[model samples]
Target: MKRALLALTIVATLATPAYAVLPDEIMADPAKEARARDLSRELRCMVCQNQSIDDSEAPLARDLRLLVRERIAAGDTDAQVIDFLVARYGEFVLLKPRLNSHTWLLWFLTPLAFSVGGIALWRQARRRARTSTERDEALSNLTPDEEARINQLIATEPVSEK
Candidate 1:
């Protein structure tokens, strides 16, 4: 039992890396780590939608992670670091894309489309209602003589036995 327990503990410890990012990857200062973590959270994971680069294991995510750490260690302010990345990569690099002329239509299009569709449906229903004759006024357009002839034809029809 003691041997089996020791083996289990060793395997579990070996399964996980001592540090996901190597000591070489980290900046010497702890202050930079906080900012690096913040920037990482803001970055999108290209390989995994909805995940931040910090949480992703993809190579691209790792590269981005490294880049952020490098920038932070190089004495770049948080905003400057972010702007640098944005300059290198377009707005698509942002996990939450900013609202702009290029994306305004994309953001508002669904509601606009729904409103237009609703209007079209309402118009179609109004047109159909206007064009159709109600059963109560089936002969409203007919003269008295025409009405009499239709009634006579109905009266002359033979009845069928059920």
Candidate 2:
């Protein structure tokens, strides 16, 4: 029925891969195709900005995918393909940036900030705990007469404002 067809369509859509690699773009040699696919995952799609070339449907992504395959076909090593892309597009072409003088700050900043925030939270919690225990200790140290006076004060009715 219509409901069964709809359920099947949903299942089929979910089963399909999100990648944009076309059958025509795939290399004939299995080894070269594997290499191309691996490299495609590392390269960024220039037009899509946030997506890897392998995952992007942009025209520029297709061109870059083809270029990677062409490089592999021409006997370029994986390192050579990466180097060529880096040289042509700068470090921004890579999905994960390389660690260098320019990127050292970017790599180290997140962990440093997380450590600082964690330490700050720990100190704050300790301070609150100490203050609360000090308050309880003060209450415990109160004389029986003082405690009676406090209870009396609480039990007394407030004076009416005229």
Location of the lowest summed lDDT over 10 successive residues in candidate 2? 151-160
lDDT of candidate 1 over 43-102, digit per residue (tens): 887788678887777788889889999888788898888889888988777887768987
- lDDT by residue (80-145, candidate 2, tens digit) is 999999999999999999999989988999999999999999999999999999999999999999
Clashing pairs in 2: none
List where candidate 2 sits over 4 angstroms from the true fold.
Answer: 156-162
Q: What RMSD, rounded to one decimal, does every model reach?
A: 8.9, 3.4
Tell me the deviation in Å of residue 126 in model 1.
Answer: 3.2
Question: Candidate 1: lDDT of 85?
Answer: 85
TM-score of 1: 0.55
lDDT scores for all predictions? 0.82, 0.95
